[model samples]
Target chain A: MTVRDPFAMTALDAVRAFRARERSAVEITRSALDRVARHDRAVGAFLRVDAEGALAAAATLDARLAAGDAMTDRPLAGAVVAVKDVLATRGLRTTCASRMLEHYVPPYDAWTVARLRDAGAVIVGKTNMDEFAMGSSTENSAFHPTRNPWDLTRTPGGSSGGSAAAVAARFAHAALGTDTGGSVRQPAALTGIVGLKPTYGRVSRYGLVAFASSLDVVSPFAQTVADAALLYESIAGPDAHDATSVDRPVERADLSRGASVLKGLRVGVPREYFGDGLDADVSAGLRRALDQMAAAGAELVELSMPHTSHAVATYYVLAPAEASSNLARFDGVRYGLRADGRDLRSLYGATRDRGFGPEVKRRILLGTFALSAGYFDAFYGRAQKVRTLIARDFTEAFAKVDVLATPTSPTVAFKLGERTADPLAMYLADVCTLPASLVGVPALSLPVGLGASGLPVGLQLIAPAFEEARLLTVAHGVEELLGRLSLPSLD
Target chain B: MAIDVTPARVRATADLARLDLRDDEVGPFAGQLQKILDHIAALEALDVSAVAPTSHVLDLACPLREDAPAPGVLRDEAMAQAPRSEQGAFVVPQFVDE
Candidate 1:
């Protein structure tokens, strides 16, 4: 096997080696599992590691290859991918980073998980996540918090922090993560990787543990756009299991095409995204990134999203309200950890009391109150209206520009426990990310530069719904310009 | 309107959700829940009478499938993790006696 540095190989590179007979699928899978064993102690990226299962799957793929299968038929064959704990994998313990479901083994694989298996990809294991994907940082996870690979003292961003950190630490070639609000993108930014949140309904939600059903999306995190696109292609399609999945055809354009310039593309910079609370270093990095695009022949325009400031407030209300309802299933009756009690009522009470993490409880209470009879009109109802305004702002802007660009997060990864005591400060991390979620748009976060604290910053590019091709095209161009030298070393 | 979530309300809500809470937890949770509610309450100030409530992002009607026998968890495995169970069913205390 070509084991110069297992962590450095992309999914494509590993597949190529397996096809060329230079390495067997078993060798690549073992290398990946070995890397996880070596580094996961410090990174805390995975909650469960299926070393034997992954090896067995790899052996099967190797046997299939020996039977003379065509490479084109199984492009992702033999590639190892990590699944976030929130996405159910049949027979594998899917925790959703909460104690309530810690021992719950799902009966069926989530839509995405089935797709991955169909594509011949070996599942490495389930990575950690915030309980029910509710928090911006993975610290809200009932299990151990994931540490940033670049700097252990810093956060890896969150909700999908484990997925991002896993990919960053090279524990997996690619990882699937859910983005509700900023779950996937912010973590990608913090970890110096690429994360893509496809348009809502573009991917099925069948096996995914729901946080905010309307806003949540399953996406991919990888070192490059091509890798993310490859993973997305495998998982994006309508599913009979999920009514919310869209039946749209995948747009097949040459994503890897080298365009010397972006001359005709109109890149809009929302004035609201560049305003007051943005960190100085983040602003500088964004400006420099825009300048690079301009130099490469793209037209830059300053646009306005009038309802931008209200996005965070609307999201806080709407998301929690949905979360409250979706999480009602874990009542200690059907599955998972149950608290001891003498009576049924006490059983329910004690189970939920001990099962939920602090953040999950707080959100459940907040959401329930927001949707209550007396408060519905004032909180949940009004947030829905504001959501429409936010969506309209994006629609208006897209009319004038092909794509909009902004900083993925206002600041780089903060110190561990920095904003844990101040919920408002933590909510602000999603300020630049929530607008796109509100509108059901496709967005990409690509590492742009390092911040003053030497952490990574991401430049976000958003396109209209189902316009992932255009977004990927622009992101690829910018990524090439930025170069991969900017990637942080976990060592 | 700023609604103050007092300890009494927290306890009541806990009861509604069927979650047990200690005396110490009620006070802190009340304070934290009140702050969160206050943050969410800011939405009430906006005017949204003309805006339509969007429940889901999809434009398609809900697709219905005919009932069919499908592979599901075995009864024993399904109840394996349950704290209390009887013959092929989850066991719970009887709420009333005839």
Candidate 2:
């Protein structure tokens, strides 16, 4: 039963319809804008919705289509995509959801944004996120928290909460999200959408506001694995602007391969990821999904990542350390919000003090202490060594199996302000997603089933670096077996 | 060695970070910092003396772009985002002593 509303269409469907001329890009974009007008007040998924710009672009595409333009090469033709505010969009404000750069607009598009436009995708708006992509829940956003579409009272797990929520709410067909630790996958799991964090160097990070440079990667949130793969392929590639982007060409995935491809697939279930901390309902859901795969002819191997408990601790230390340095550039003189003071020193201090949020301030302090004159060896240096050990764990595990499976998050979407009082509890949400990030490998979060609270549970799949095609192929198999999770009732 | 997260140390670190903290923020930050540090102390149990630090996970080194100047973020375009600017230069409080 089609909902008749264009917002109900997945990006793949929308593109096919556009190609068939069943619906104009204007119709699809207007439907999404209407949905945003109706529901965004409660969901808070978007920081800014570019309705006029989106419609204008869509109208242009419609006009070209009317002229019988053969746009077969454009896979994302007329698909409305929401960009995480952290990415630079020319003329549009890219806030990073932080007060520091609230009014900042980039002169040039991020490499990915430019690529998206090149692929015939219309950017609808900038989605909200945790301030500087620093928090596990969108509550850290200076503007407001993006509520889970599944239930308004709960969080859409975050720093990519708004992006995931936008896709889940059908406000945007898909969205670009950055994962540093669990930002993309964690939120994707909670919101019941597919979120893929490509290998660290797979996607260009030129326009993504530096969070944790070493750990940061841009990915996509969509209803289907195919849509996610489409967005992933478009934005991922080598760029001269970002030297860390791999020099190799992007290896596109054959998403058309169905569940039969799972036969003889060697799937490993890490014993460490299923320890005491995992929620019982989530754990059960993951087991049931794995059993389905096993029944489908995929082999499951039990493995261990002994340093699992150390991941969150290590991530907190290293991410903050990198952030401390990257954030030094927002010193009021170059760009963004600034506060006046009597002297240069006072100006720097005042600007930062007024601009940065509590969470950001806390991280800067933690990072500052970690990299200080006397303690660098014990804190920052030690974390990097531990990082080497984590990478080695992935290297050894992949030798035994094609992919590793685990829970995307320890628990389902927690109530807003539930873990806000205790910061460590909040940090622990990233435990499952952090290990793969530290290793610079690819990871995808797919909705396996729902938990006791009626919210979704996400099963994470990890692959070796540059094995995104393999990762998505396996994900496509699982998605076929699991079927699509129903959209949440927004009333 | 036991990590000491004293209020004085928190104050000093914030100073080094070029951030000014309120009187109340220092105490809370000191407590939270100590807790996070204590958790991070778990790393002390593992001996990584033989392991080398990984600054970047990718095996990339010195990727230099063409030195040729192409039109980049124009001065006016860049200045548009600046909170305070004058005549193509970012305006800031004087640093050198008069």
Candidate 3:
């Protein structure tokens, strides 16, 4: 059956249709590919579209379903899943949007990618991203910028911009994104979709191109919180390949039980997140969400996270310090595109000089300088101390409140090229989302309302580490109470 | 404190990193590096003497598994994208002349 409204169909609905044989997996995959063909020219969501590979995978899924197989054995069978280019996929060019590895094709899949494949999710293609997952907009990509589906002139937030945009534009039912200082949630907020960055260690990192190894996380973006949770469950768990992967049972989030009023749930609104620099529209949207929660039987408690302001400063230092070490592997020797030169040293210099884009080189230089021997104690060391205080702030806040709420970003999607020239301003775009990353908290970004410019504003719900289930439940409640139907039509 | 990423420091870092920079690049890179260092110098202003350092977010301790020969990508496939290779291994010029 042809899927004319694939964007409206939820993940659960897609799975049911596929299992009932109402629609073949090939048809669904083709519909998504067709959408990509029509919209990706403007949105720039995908770096590569594996038409032949996607069709082959869909054919296999169709065969499995036709053989009268039990659908219960595969939770995500026949679903289309797009992965950010940062995550490695066997034989696919995983560029991470950097020219250094432009021609690189991995021989193995990342742990999460392998899990998704085992769950029978079709690997549609790799999406665009900021080089090394650094920038707040996908414009940092060496290739092209991913435009917001809501307004083509505006940016889809980055470095997971392409993933969020693809799902928002109906190019894929759901997509995987990496969250390093709000890459996943910020984009989800900008594009009016569900993005979840699970607690640190909750998901495996094996084979994912490293940016800041400690702070980076793989997350999911979907049209609904339940769909994001479904994708999250399939890829989260212990993996021998990733030492940081948590050895815990997957906490299944059941949103189908219906949205229950968050009675007796204590929601904390951090005073620091609502301070100066927050746009009037964002503040209004967040306040409206909080008011809805209060009316729905949840207690809105005024909380203080004094360390929130230092998050941006601390993140800039720590992320780069870690990046300096992690990115050292990209020298001319490894498997990737290399620039030729007369000798070994010249080869290394030319490879890095020509291969990396401006943003990537800037970050590498900053990181290297920060970690240099004389400056290490003054820069990298101080940031680490601030990190401790940031984490402590969350630990204390969670003791008094079950969840924390804030505006996902200070403003709606800005016009492309607005802040591209100003690196510091681009960094500030991640202000509200960075604290959660620093504290290793589970956070979800869901659309609250439309901004003055008619773009969607995101409200972030945060819970203590390993509390993804509670976070999703609280988000689901807020989503129902808002009742502001802001979903855009892709047709 | 005022600091400059001078040509001398650039050369030092490039040597440490084993990269050769052209003379023309040295001057431009030095100016760019100086501006970045100036921006990052803000970190030095924070007071963190009593606070404990946090390098990683997870409270991880010995999460490593026992040593075993786990499956890995084949050597040929792994090296397929390498720019220069010889005798089934990546080739680099010798660091020191014989």
Compute each candidate's TM-score over C-alphas. Answer: 0.96, 0.98, 0.95
Candidate 2 local Cα displacement, residue A256, angstroms: 3.2
The list of candidate 3 runs beyond 4 A from truth reads A1-4, A484-486, B1-46, B64-66
Error of 1 at A86 (Å): 0.8
RMSD to native, candidate 1: 1.8
Tell me how candidate 2 scores on lDDT. 0.91
What is the two-chain DockQ of model 1?
0.61
Kindly give the stretch of ten consecutive residues in candidate 3 chain A with the minimal lDDT sum.
A1-10
Model 3 error, position A129 (Å): 0.6
lDDT tens digits by residue: candidate 1, B1-98: 78879888888776766667778778878887777667666666667788897666557787878899887668877777676788888877676766
Q: What are the per-residue Cα lDDT tens digits for candidate 2 across A1-491?
A: 33377777889889888888888999899888988999999999999999888998899888888898878767798699999999999888899999999989889999999988878898899999999999999999998889999999999999999999999998989999999998999999999999999999989998899989999999999999999999999998899888898888788777677888789999999899998998888999999999999999999999988888899889999999999999999788888989999988999999999899989999999998889888899989999999999888888999999999999999999899998877878997789999999989999999998978799999999999999999999999899998999888585
Best by lDDT: 2
Candidate 1 per-residue lDDT, tens place, A1-491, comes to 56576557888887787888877888888888888887899999999999988999999999988998766767688578999999999888999999899888888889999988888888899998888897888999898999998899988989999999999888888999999998999999989999999999989999899899989999999888888888988899888787888888988435665445377789999999998888888898899999988988889989899988888888888898888888878877878887867777887788888999878887777777778778787888788888888888988999999999999999888888998887767886799999899888999999987878778889999999998888887888787887763444555
Of 2 and 3, the candidate ranking higher by TM-score: 2
Pick by TM-score: 1 or 2, better one:
2
Residue A481, model 2: Cα distance from true site in angstroms? 0.7
Q: Higher-lDDT candidate among 1 and 2?
A: 2
